[model samples]
Target: MTRKLLLVLLFLMAVEMNAQKGESNFSLGFNYGFGSEFSNRNYMFTNQFYKVQLYYRLKETKHFQYQILVQPEINFAEHQLLNFYFVKPDTPNYQQKRDEFTRLKDIREYVLNCGFLVRKPIGKTCSFYVLGSIGPMITDTETERMSKGFAFADVLAVGFAASYDKFKFDIRPSVRHVSNAGLGSSNAGYNTKNIEFGISCQL
Candidate 1:
């Protein structure tokens, strides 16, 4: 947890440093998403999360801009039992395995994301954007049967943005995918589909 806290502090500090240089292209943002999780069996599990984002972008043209985002998220709720990996009932160890793995329902996650954003202005202060990101993530709760404690993650999102003076806000719908990327033999990976509503202020 200490490393995570340090990362958060460093992220904020970078933004602060940039602001002191008279850069007005930085924005601080917060996002919340509601979505369903789907597993290998084609099931949807209930989950929700909150994200805090820091964004920096440069206007490349009258209608185009480039953006970068550093975001951290805290996930809440838990997956339903129907999505768990379970041993066959016929196996002698089935009951024991089930009991052991069931506790993961209270799992919480820490995710750090960095992304590149592409924007096209609709008109003046309103714009449309698409983004792609890669990052690292860890979960506090999971079956130890899995080898690794962390995995690589990906994010893809599309959103609409509106700028009003020095304040801006947007709504983004996105998908997040996490995979161990061969670090573990069991890389089932996880996916979440959700929408994020965000508000930000220019520095």
Candidate 2:
């Protein structure tokens, strides 16, 4: 199901590319993030993701530009349950479950993000932007906080970009949240703070 959804998005992007008269760009990015201490579970989480982004400018003015973004990424993560007491003493097989959930675990996630961007030019070669996106994700491992399989990832970010000739460099700091939106039994999502670096070219 995720593969089919990705294919459909790609097809739609291709069609939109051919139809649109505005500027477009393609970018590659690397992100590193660590979990924030806001959840009920006592766990430590960190992640790294490689991203591919497509941006299509919808409107441009002297001061601001609006664009649509489609991003697909491969994510690698590490999680460790810090406090065994989080499992509770009364649960069945509590000791075994605590041992299982406390061990350091590696996780993988595939994500597709669709979003919008608003940019304000600061100089001839520099701009600042705000972006918001939400998308479907697939997790390859289950842990105490969230179940394996389908979920949703949402992001909000602000960034700076510098342009030189045909190339652009970007640095963005973002907040991310992932959950199944109650589709699964476990819904204690992960929240993280992230920083990303990217380079792109007009296409």
Candidate 3:
């Protein structure tokens, strides 16, 4: 897991350097979640999800801009985000809260995804936007039964961004979905509601 995280970070740094030249803009963002009510469970703060991303601009107009990004995320505590099954309340595999906590204690997920963003500025320096992207994701797990280790993913997001000189800041709300794309029997998938906000600069 450490190696995976390290490699992702390195990749982000490389992208950062690449974005500094020509017409490209460099963006970095951090996001977290408040969970969701899904088929499996009522999510909570304990079902933590956080993401860090680096983006490079692709195109822009006075009110619209497009970009691409690579995101690295961590999902911890609530085991639901890491699993491939659609859990029901009365399932035979149900466990007490303590047991659930115990099982999730050691579980940590490291995920990487490539994505795209389409932003529209409301003002010269501030704007609202929508984003969508699909990519592949992998998780760290001892058992393949929980997940296939690799999956197809997608995200839908809306956000706002503002700039000051060469610096920029933004916030976003997003719904991220992931599925093994039928690679596993328990391919019900996972969905997370997230708020991603951050800063960027044009060079």
Report every candidate's CA lDDT: 0.72, 0.82, 0.63
Error of 3 at 130 (Å): 0.7
lDDT of 3 by residue, 1-203 (tens): 54576587667667767866654466666666545434443222234567766677878876678888777777663452344232444655544422352344334556676777787777678887788877766755422224547776687888877789877777777787767887865565666676655765553
Instruction: Note each model's CA RMSD in angstroms.
Output: 3.8, 3.1, 5.6
User: lDDT order of candidates, best first?
Assistant: 2, 1, 3
- After superposition, the stretches of candidate 2 with alpha carbons farther than 4 Å from their true spots are 1-41, 90-92
Which model scores highest in TM-score? 2
Lowest summed lDDT window (length 10), candidate 2: 25-34
Candidate 1 local Cα displacement, residue 24, angstroms: 1.1
Which ten contiguous residues of candidate 1 have the minimum total lDDT? 140-149
- Clashing residue pairs found in predicted model 1: none
| Deviation of model 3 at 189, angstroms | 1.4
Q: Candidate 1's residue-wise lDDT over 16-105, tens digit each?
A: 776686656677888888776754552335567888777877557876789888878877746534434544587456677566655546
Candidate 1: lDDT of 87? 45
Candidate 2 per-residue C-alpha lDDT over 4-104 given as tens digits, one digit per residue, 9 for 90 to 100: 76587567667766876875443333343434434545998888888777676788887899988878888889988888887788867889989998999
